[model samples]
Target: MTERHNAFFTDIAEATRLTQAGRLGEATALIQRSLGGANLSAEGARPTDASPAPHGTPRLEGPATRLDPEVDAAQATLIPERLRENIDHVMQGLRSLVPSLNGLTGGGQQAPGPNGTEPDGVASEGGQFVERSFSNAAGARDYKLFIPSPRSGPRPLLVMLHGCSQSPEDFAAGTRMNTLAEEEGVYVAYPRQTSRANAQKCWNWFEPGDQGREMGEAGIVAGLVRAICAEHSIDRSRIYIAGLSAGGAAAANIARAYPDLFAGLGVHSGLAAGCARDLSSALSAMRVGAPGAAEPGGAAGFGAGAVTQKLRVPTIVFHGEGDGTVHPRNADAVLAQAGIEALTPRQEGGINGRHSYTRTRYADDAGRIQVEAWSVQGAGHAWCGGSSAGSYTDPNGPDASRAMLDFFLSHSLTGGQG
Candidate 1:
């Protein structure tokens, strides 16, 4: 009963069946073959040198599937009218959103998947993933905490924020940051963004209400971090925050808001804090660098002399040169916003094989490294040196987890700032 007309639908159904049956590797290949995508991992990465993004959830970009006019009309109700648009228009909008909608659709991930991944950080690799929550005057947020093996003294804390549409589990699997925590005796916390806040589960870094030091999302996140520090005996001087995409953008803003709280910062494919004030400007910033920023989200967005007056913190940045979702110029904008432009950087080229990159490092008057940036060659809006088990990861080269953690630990909060 194999009908020639039903081949495509049949293949799709079989792929779904395989995915549900936990044959992720095979299901991914079939979906790619059926959809005419390149040989790619479940995370839209190549298993080898071809892969080069991290923590950025895979997008649903593909050749438009044309249907009969009657079929199109019949399926119009499948999507809400307000959300309906031509493929090009929808793709353009999605690009600006810097979305990670893969989990919502349930296409590929598996339970008890590779690297011992599980929902809510359960079934992890030799560490405990505990669920926790924090509420403040601003709002409430739930988070997952990764506790390393028993240690004698205080441990360093790393606050990790996930990209749009990604959860703590997905981000952990992608970046393998928790693995680093286990190996290095560090505590990791993942703050969740509720859908009630943003439809995409994106951090509201661009919103004026959320950017304040003691208001909105920034306050709530900082409160949570402080609570964790007290509860887990975290080293205040060693605390750091990092995020991918919107989370990265949020990290930048949070660091500025609470300069004395975090000692180091990491932004991966993210925009600078204060890059935009609302959705419109956020979209523009994500597309092209913020031209009106006065100094890449500094003087204009915050105020005159706001950044220069603040204490400096050590920071490390990672961005793919080919990131289409978030303009690569945003990276330069981030450095400028951090005031690294005032210091001359010693540039190094071609570190690590396959997905070669150029690294820039800057030091201060004391000869201490203050800032580092990685410009990944031919990479895109994803986490670098991540595992393929999670969404938005590219298993290429130049491990971001190692590089970021090393950078964070090397600098401690001395006199309330790095």
Candidate 2:
């Protein structure tokens, strides 16, 4: 259809469909588009003066809609009655509530659709928050990318994965990675792990079927990374991956499955390989953590050894000594397997027997796998030096965020081969 006709048809469809579907905000958007296209007033056939009303006056129309001045001087004046009514009806239908539910009864109102992803798939975009969806025969996933304004030269991309039972916003706020990304000149993307894979919403990193080549969960992650790179001019050589717990394991899988795609991997209180060889082994490996044993996660008779054989990239490891979920021993073994020999600790005395790390090259050649380990004294399974606004967070140890960024920024693909 022609643009003009499309607008008319959209307005008609929106008004009819949204009213029936009880989605007035979307209907209003369609109406506005129609008015803009037809050069008519915002209220469609309804018209109003282009100029503002006199300073002391408030405009009113019959029952269609209403408007009233919000200031103190206009208490007694009745605003556009038709406009006011239309807005109220739309607001109620749209289910847009005042921020917070302290005042509203029965909690707040229902969002437009499942998980607030409207059937029409329209949501407010505030920042570099770009919403994109990807799907294949297996399933589909939705992700968001936050890019800073006035893009700088090709920037490093950090793929942030959310933990079990969490969404991208939940993970973003919990990690506070976006704040750091803004400070640094880097771009960050959050890939959501759907709940269908596991009831707990954990990434199925422990499943034998979850690893190797383009198959199962690994395939989904690879697809996401490829799609993101294709859509954005991401620095292919500077791409890094980080995740927490389940998400962390998924990050490791990504590095292992597609070593060429990622420059480094950050596993936070997460498991390694050899844990999910078979059904029973997968459970044990996931619960106990993967380390030392070769073939960290594969079938029982599938060979016994660590999965990290080659020095694909430098890795920064972080784990709390008091971690109850994933043992600190796993961290040590991962460093050893990845060939990261720890140098002397930095900042000797702090709350958790304070220590920051310095790493040397992975092999005899320079620019190979460089690794650092943060052993936070008495710290638990949490973000080292995380804010109080999140869970599984502790701020008493070396800041993991700064260290990871530094490691990621220091290495480049071409310069690493010397």
Best by lDDT: 1
**Which 10 residues in a row give candidate 1 its minimum summed lDDT?**
62-71
lDDT of 1 at 364: 71
Cα displacement (angstroms), candidate 1, residue 261, comes to 0.4
Candidate 1 Cα errors over 4 Å, as ranges: 1-125, 292-311, 351-353, 415-418
lDDT of 2 by residue, 1-418 (tens): 7988866754554354443333344445455445442222333221221332232331111111112111211311232445545545644543443233213221121123335332211122223444455555444565666665445577788887766555565556556676677667677777655433454456666665566657666776678777777867778888888887767766776777777878888878776643455445544554565544334343342233444353355677778778776777777655665665433233233443253333223332443446666666677777786655445567567777777777777766666622
lDDT of each: 0.70, 0.57
Cand. 1 Cα-lDDT: 0.70
Name the best candidate (by TM-score).
1
lDDT of 2 at 261: 79
Give candidate 1's TM-score: 0.69
For candidate 1, lDDT tens digit of each residue in 197-262?
A: 665567887776677688788888899998897788788888899999989988988887887899
